[model samples]
Each structure stands twice: as C-alpha cells, then as structure tokens.
Target: MIPRVPRLQVTELVLDNCRSSNGEIEGLNDSFKELQFLSMANVELTSLAKLPTLSKLRKLELSDNVISGGLEVLAERCPNLTYLNLSGNKIKDLGTVEALQNLKNLKSLDLFNCEITNLEDYRDSIFELLQQITYLDGFDQEDNEAPDSEDDDDEGDEDDDDDENEAGPPGEYEEDDDEDDGASDLGEGEEEEEVGLSYLMKEEIQDEEDDDDYVEGGDEEEEAEGVRGEKRKREPEDEGEEEED
Candidate 1:
C-alpha cells in the first residue's frame, strides 16, 4: 500500500517453512528495495522471479525451495546481497551460478544437496568460481561453527553496560586503575597474557572476514543489466533505469 522502497526497508524477514503451492506468489514490485536481509527458506519458491526489484538486498535465504527458473534474474535483482542459501533445492546443475559473477557483495553461499553430485564434471570449478565465499553449505563446517561469537559479543556488551552504570557518569570521580598500579607497562603485559592476544587476533581476523565477500566477480552483473534493460526498454525508454536506491 505504501510507496515501494520504504515498506521493504526491513532488514530481516523470514517466511520460511511455508508449504504452499505455486499459486501463493502474486506480484513483485520495486518496493523490496529496502530489504537488506531476507529469509524465505523452505517455502514453495518455484519462481523467484517474483522479486525483480529488490536491488539493495544484502542477505537472502531461499533454501529448501523448489526453485526451477529465473535464478540469473534473481542474482541481478539482488546484486548487493552477500549471503545466499540455495540449499535443498532441485537445481540439479550450475547454470545459474555462472550469472552470479556479478554478485560482488556475496559473502556466504549455501548449495547443500542441490543434486550437483558430479561437481567436478561441470565446466566451472564450484569452489574456484566462488572463491570469495567464506562459507559454503556442503563444506566449510569449521567457519560455520562460529555461531557462538554472537553470544560472546553480547556478554561483553552487557559487562560494559554494567560497568558504566556503576561508574555513575563520565566525569564522576573514578580512580584510574592504572594510576594506582604505579606503572602502566607493569600491568599491560599481564592483561595481554590473561586475555590471550592470540584469541584477540583471531577474533579480529574473524570480524574482518565476517563481512568479507563469500563470492566474487561482476561480468555476470553486466549481463543481468542487459536482460533487465531489455524488459524496461520494451515499456518506455524514459523508464529504462529507475533510481532504485
């Protein structure tokens, strides 16, 4: 009902586990321009082309669906999207992935049980093509085991909040612990040893990689533009490229 972009500004939306038929999907509009993250896993998504306008989507989950067509179109529409889940689909081959070279922001891609049994038989190296993907569905279990980092980060924030409350205010009389220690260098070593700099370094690396691309390439993106442009040109040259962002 509202203007297209503002309504789809929601970052997270999950419509997974819905067991409907093809008739469920109706119309898709430029409104989904606001979604940075979305999850429609386990839904009956036989035609993902319904969403032809969600250009700013950063994360998408369409695993366990019955997707058969319009994958390249989906990739073009979701160029900024970094995380994708195509697991548990009947997509038997790698036709759609070739067009994904345009997805420069794609970070994590899931393709578990996609009927791609003979992956080596394909022309493109599944891993080599998506070299940037840090997390792949069928493999890369160790990286995926990092779900606990979220919990640990939460605890650290909570502790910081508690300390802030006890400290009263920013300018309140609070003894600088280092002043009483006589020498700042004296305790810095101990703190570093206690916290384990190794762990901190690992966390930093993980954080850097957290938002890094899990997939790469952009030539495929140009192809997407060509395809989309064809559709718009057929309607009106003036409306060929609407400012989606």
Candidate 2:
C-alpha cells in the first residue's frame, strides 16, 4: 500500500502498472479531494465502477488496459475530464466509445491500437459522435495536430524566458547608439586633422616658392650692379684715352 500523506492536498496521482483495480486502493476517492490528474494505465483495471468521484480531475490515463466497456462511469465520476487516454485497450465498437459523449468537458481522447480504430468510418464516426472533442487520438476532426503536453509547454515557456533575457533591457539599445555617435565623432575629428595637415602642406609649398623667387631676384640685382661698374670703368678709360690723344 502507498504511504498516506496529506491526501487532500494531492493534485496528481499515478498508479500505473500497479496490478490493482480502482476499488483495491484504499481511500483513493475520499482522500484525494483536490486531485486534478490521475494515471491508472496498465493496472489491469477491467472496470471503473470503483473509480473515485473526481470532479476536479482534468486528465486521466488508462492506456494498455483490459477495459472493454463501462466508460459511462467516467462521465459520472470525472465529469470535468478534459483529456483521457484509453489507447491500446479492448474497445472494439463505436457503441462502446459513444459512452464518452456524456463527458461534456472532454476535449481529447486517445483510442489508438484498439479494435474500434479498424472500423471503416472510425475516425469520421467518432468525430461526429464526440463533437465536443477537439482531438481524437492525436488529430482533430479536420486532421489538425493536437497541442503538445504540459512538459513541452514548460519547455516552451523556458525558451521564451531565455529569449526575453537575451533581448536584455531597453537601455542596451541606447548604449549602442551612444557608441555609434562616439565613433562618428572620432571619424570627423580624423577628417579635420587630415584637412589641417593638407592646409599646412600647401602653406609650406607657397613659402618655398617665395624663397626661390627672392633668390632669383637677388641674383638679377647683383648682375645689374656688376654691369653698371663695368660701364663706369669703361667711361673713365675712354676719357683718359681722349686726354692722351
């Protein structure tokens, strides 16, 4: 027997492969008042007569069992069940599956590997009969895939959180803008320095040209002075020759 705890606080229970019927478990019905999920898969349960009245139960697993009929008890005991897996069971006929119609809250049901699945119009008939169910086995009436399990949902939630964290705070974008601005300013400063250097080079070239012109002018003035001196000496010699004559 499973050890007892605060059973009323229990929201989930798994008795899979226990080789016992629902009635065999002591205090399952009375103890688990808050139970919302239950799994009795492969437990060799032939009937649900002794199943607990779990109005809060939303999901139940009874796969791979010998349960052939008497599914109406589920509608009575777990009226709020949204998901039920009765796959790999002995359910053979559409009439037997019709018993689930009473479960108004049932949105998903699995009867895979069952004899009923081999029926000619099994998929069509089940959809027509259970109009409220969004998924039969794993597909909807329109053949759309069903949503993933809760564990997958949790993983998706974690991925979303990681994405949010990777995105970082809003201020991060502002920091990037500031860095771009700094780079732009640095580039402009470099451009200004290049221009200043070009201007200085032009000034130096102009000064060099002026110095060359000054040197040429000085040479020309010295040549003119030398010519005047020669002319003066020649005039003096001419006067002396005339006197001698």
Candidate 3:
C-alpha cells in the first residue's frame, strides 16, 4: 500500500499493477493538477471514464491492460500529452487510434502486441492517420530510431561536457609549466658545461706560459757556457805565442 502524498506537489505517479476495475484509483483526480507523468500499466482498467483531467500531463503509460476503447477521453483529459503507451491492449483497428488525433501535442504512441499491428500497411496507415505523431511503436515515419525518454540524462551529459571544456585551459597551462621547467633544467646543465670548459681552458693556458719560461731559462744557460769555452781557447793561444817567441 502506498501512502497518500500531497496531491499538489505530485508531478509524476506510477500505479502499475494496482487493480482497478473501472480504471479509477482512489484519491486520483483533478486534484493532482500538477501531474505531468502517469503510469497505470497492468491495472485491469477497462475504460478511461474515471480518469482525472490532468491538463499538464505529458506522458501516460497504460500498457498490458484491458483497455479496449475509450481513448478519446485522453485527448479531452490530458490534452498536452506528448507520449502515450497502449501496448499489449485490445486496440483492434485504425479507427480506435483515431481518437488520439485530438491530442495535438502527442509525439509518440506505442501499440505493440495489439491486434491493429497485424493489419496490412499498419505502420504506413498509422503515420498517415496520426500525422502529428513523430513515433509509432518506437520509430519515426522514416523508420529512424526514436529518441528515448532520458531528457534529464542528456542534460547531465551536456553539463559534464561543459565542465570539461571550462577546465581545459587550466589543464593545458599545467602542461606548459612542466615544459618550461624542463627547459630551465636544460639551461642550467648547459651553464655548468660552459663553466667546466672555461676552467679547463684557463689551466691549459697557464701550462703553456710555464713551458715558455722554462725554455727561455735553458737557452740563457747554454749561451753562458759557449762564452766560457771561447775565453779558454784564447788563453791557450796566448800561451802558444809566448812559447814561440
């Protein structure tokens, strides 16, 4: 047993499999003025005579019931209905579905497993009869797949995409920072190599200067020895001249 909720606040209701011989549920009436969606499948409902007038109702599901006729009440009661499911019911012919033509806002209708589906040119005839319906039995007139009733989910997915797009620039900025860090590290390494090569060149120049100084000192010593040899030869020549005299 479901507890009674505040009728004014109720926007959606599901009473599937709740037995109601005359298609009326206790406490369900025009008092639920805000109701937008309703499901009463498998409820043993034989008629829509007792159904409430819900001007804002957009979706109604009465599948797997004994609802043989009286669909005209739907247009009068729920004029704004955008979707209606009468599958597995006793709808037998196109005329039975013609009652829905008054529902100008109806976009989709499902009558699967009904006797009317077995008729020749069923899909074509229905599309022709209900020109406003975009989908019959879950397909469009062009045989294209119909859109599902997950509008909120689609909005959520679009929000997620927007969030990702909003955060994209920050994510790219972080990657750019990482690249700049890498370039800074390479610059530091190059600086270190330059410092090391500068030290090595300084050491090589100092060693060359020391070698030049050593070579100059050795040449001065050899020149002094040659002068000393010339003086010795002159002294011997002078002694030989005195002896000859």
Can you write out model 2's per-residue Cα lDDT over 141-245, one digit (the tens) per residue?
778898887547889999999988998876878878999999999999999999999999999999999999999999999999999999999999999999999
lDDT to native, each model: 0.68, 0.88, 0.91
Candidate 1, which ten residues in sequence have the lowest lDDT sum?
141-150
Model 3, range 5-117, lDDT digits (tens) per residue? Answer: 88998999999888985565555878899999999999988888888899999999999988889989999899999999999999999889999999999989999999999
Using TM-score as the measure, which candidate wins?
A: 3
* Model 3 lDDT at residue 240: 98
Kindly report which residue pairs in candidate 1 clash with one another: 4-31, 107-214, 132-214, 133-214
Arrange candidates by TM-score, descending: 3, 2, 1
Name the lDDT of candidate 1.
Answer: 0.68
Give per-residue CA lDDT, model 1, range 68-152, as digits (tens): 5567776667777767788788776666675676777766677777876457743236656766665565344344442423336
Clashing pairs in 2: none
TM-score of 3: 0.64
User: lDDT of candidate 2?
Assistant: 0.88
Mark the regions of model 2 whose C-alpha exceeds 4 Å error after superposition.
1-4, 21-27, 150-245
Ranking by lDDT: 3, 2, 1
